[model samples]
Target: MPDALADALYELIVATRILANEKVLDAFGHVSVRHPLDPQRYFIPRHRAPELAEISDLVELTLDSEPVRPTDFRLYSEKVIHGEIYKARPDVHAVCHHHAHAVLPYAISGQEIVPVFHLGAVMGKVQFWDQRDEFGDTNMLVVKPEEGASLARALGPHWTVLMRRHGATVAGTSLRELTFRTVFTCDNARLQSQAMAHGRVDALSPGEVKLTAAHQLRPPSTNRAWDYWVRQVEKAGLMPARAAAKGASTTAARAKKADAKRAPTKSARKNSVKSKRRR
Candidate 1:
């Protein structure tokens, strides 16, 4: 494709797969990007197993929520939510929806994604919209247009939204920022979920949160580096099935394998057995 959107989308998909293989997203989450050639259209991959997605799996959708079906391709039902948001808000270009375990409990409870971790500290005071009664689709609760508007209103200027009883939604200017934000969203949730066990969690003050959010900028180079590394990892010996389907050439694969073998899987220190955190 002439547009760079596909490359960008695929990078996020690979980044997403890294999360799934790492046990962050199971099989039910999704990540999407605005079609560079078609702003009124967005690209969302089918609701397939996360680890198996590639650039080829993505389907295009209209702003009114119609999936422009390619030959033999199916659409994910949650497009109802994603499409509505794109139409309602012009600033958002990418939207990530996932059911990370750490955030589900809070989502069901209608609680806001609080500023517990430094990331959440950067996320300003989040608003929890009270519109569950309007949402009846239990499997994909964000179905109604009115409910979408409610959620968007709740998200107001914030980059993330905790969809009550369903999952969380994050919007960003580009795929990389969206990917990193999604990971951090889950990490913050995991940390905060753990902290609330003790007592009330401390949230950064509004001014502090604003300052952090303003200063948080991953340069284009940083996102580019992340995208490249994630794709390299995905093309490595990550999942046999996915690798068999659309992995790198034999020579590239061999080189990646050799590099990974040289590097440590669990830890550099043999006795400690510590895990490396995926960025």
Candidate 2:
């Protein structure tokens, strides 16, 4: 079995891929897990083909976006966006940022991740920064620390925020919960978009939203929702446990072959020596 960290990290990465494959994440996007030992830092898999990531590939970065790898100094260019979010929100241990087809209009629009449906109520009355200085038509704002700070203020206490014309953000106290926010926010937005397609939309009442919030404020229930979503990922075979297992076996076999090749051969030195002493 994988170590605790590896298991959890892979689970999160797999979940991110599932969302990406579902088209929740576009050409460029990310999900990060806060380091348990270091609150000021997090781990994220760097560039090149989102579909190809493994537990060991994730690199840790400081809030300033520096990686331990000297060659990886580039880090996640906009990693400060996530860093500031982690710093500002004590309740959040995971965050997801990605683009969505239906969310694009809402991202750029004056609209917020409002409680348009029951699922959205979990976000605790969503809000938006509405063209913040740092993120004008972009998903990131790590160009400057002050600008990133401004974005943090806009994120506020809500679990969801829409960066106009860029994308959406979701934070949760746990990896599962954050992923739940990430997954459900898109779902709720799509549903709202569909409903609004009729032109005459019936917005959820404040009282109704509040009632939903009361029931889903925390769980017993929301946790179950998060777990169920993970199972759904498994059921759809996107988790692909078999693939993961096969990959592991293949890796082990390659390592064994490498070790055998590197092993000292009794005749190896004789094979390379001069006839004078090698025999």
Candidate 3:
């Protein structure tokens, strides 16, 4: 594999494991990264638990969410979630779909997820997409292109969108950023819930949201969190094969290089819009 592609796949696997370890994804959710060399394709693991994802488990699919080659491996039924978002948002190179426990109440209750703290600002303005709004409900899985496209339209230019009564999908300009947002978004939800139990929850003001997000979502902050999460995964003995072979020094070097290559541009950062009430 080319260095860029190999690094992307390696980080993708690491992101999957990190999210699983953090409980942002239990068994059903998935994480994917767009092809570094090809805009029309993306890579995600075949049907499996996020914790078990490895480099070999990845399968490339077109933006239409069709497999590039015939494979006996079962694909994710919601793979279209990743593909359609890629088609809709060129600035997004990574996507994560999860039904994390902390975010479930918001999804089920249609409550808005706002920045209750500084780190939570990374989530920007969370959007909402109800399948029933257009499809009038079925199994609730985004298995069809039209379904995924609807979700993508709801996502608009935001970094995260909640699927009503289902889960939330997060997009990022890089795999590390995706992982950072997924984990912290869950943390923010849990915090917000706890705060609500005490008294009125004061979410960050719009100016605070923009300022904090600009500061916290930088490469240095993301790198720090990524290193910490990778260590946690390593301690759990969940590191992917390639990452383990590369060792910490090489892994850190590659991470820096990947960040340099895939870091979000100014336009990409501006893509996150302020939160708007959705019903």
Candidate 4:
């Protein structure tokens, strides 16, 4: 595959595994990446355990959430969540939806999920969407275009939105950014819940959030988190065999290079002898 296509697929796969590894996704949540070759299409796996997703399971769908090609695999019922968000937000290149337990309390109560730390500062001011308010409450699933569009309107320019009695949706300019935001949002929710017990929590001010979020979006910051999470998933044997084997080889190569640098060579020993004599 071409580099661009390969990178997109790799990021999609890694993002799924990373979210599952971080506990933001289990068997329920889904992640999607806009097609690299065609903006009108996106790629997401057919319904399956996220941690076990392989490249073959990925299905390409139109912006309306219709599969580009017919397949026997069952598509996710709430895929409209990804479709309508992409339709509404052209700047968004990746989307993730998770039924994380940490954010459930705030989602159910219509409480704002604010950034409690610099990492989660992408969630500067999260908006909440209530299915009951718009659709009179059926199953609370975003299965229709109208329902998804309503949720996207609530999201506005924010990176995340809480879905009442359901879960949360996060979008990003890239898969790495989306992965980082999703994981940290869940972590922030956990922290916020714990701190709220002491009466009040000092969430980051909008100005502070803006500053910290700018720093976190830098390539170095995102790559650091991605590397860490990917390693954790690979080491735990949760990733596919090809990815795990590649990770193992990459790790071994790095270790070998480090050992070679640390061990003194004949030239280095000669230089050390001279230095010792001078001492």
**Could you tell me every candidate's TM-score relative to the true structure?**
0.73, 0.74, 0.86, 0.85
| Candidate 3, pairs of clashing residues | none
Off by over 4 Å in 3: 242-279
Worst 10 residues of 4 by lDDT: 270-279
lDDT by residue for model 4 (1-279), tens:
335655677678889989998999977889999977568778888788887777767776677777655456777878888989999999999999999999999999888777887887976578889988889957777887798899999999878999988899999999999988888889999998888887778878888988999999989999998899989987988766676445434533443454357433333333331111000
Maximum-lDDT candidate: 3
**TM-score: model 2 vs. ground truth:** 0.74
Would you list the C-alpha lDDT of every candidate in the order shown?
Answer: 0.62, 0.63, 0.84, 0.80
- Model 3: weakest 10-residue lDDT segment is 270-279
| Pairwise TM-score winner, candidates 1 and 3 | 3
RMSD (Cα, Å) of candidate 3? 9.2
Q: Compared with the true structure, what per-residue lDDT tens digits does model 3 show for residues 1-279?
A: 346876787788889999999999897999999988778778888888989876777776678776654456778888889999999999999999999999999999998888999999999899999999898848989888899999999999999999998999999999988998999999999999999999999999999988999898899999999999999998998887654535433533543464466424333224323211111
Q: If ranked by TM-score, best first, what sequence of candidates would result?
A: 3, 4, 2, 1
List, residue by residue over 1-279, the lDDT tens digit for candidate 1.
Answer: 232543555455666676675455787777777766557777666657767776656655566455443224555556656777787778878877777887788788866667775566534454555454655434455655566666777778777777666677777777666666666667788888888888898977778777766656456543664656576565775533445334323322333354456424223223222211111
lDDT of 4 at 6: 54
Per-residue lDDT tens digits of candidate 2, residues 1-279?
544444456665776766666677756677888865457557776653444555445665555545433333234455666778887887788877766776778877766546577877666656675545544554444445565566678888877777766677777777766766676677878888887777866667888877876676476776787567667667776664656645544533443453366323333333332211000
Candidate with the larger lDDT of 2 and 3:
3
Candidate 1: lDDT of 32? 73
Which portions of model 1 show Cα errors greater than 4 Å? Answer: 1-3, 129-131, 136-140, 144-150, 220-236, 239-279
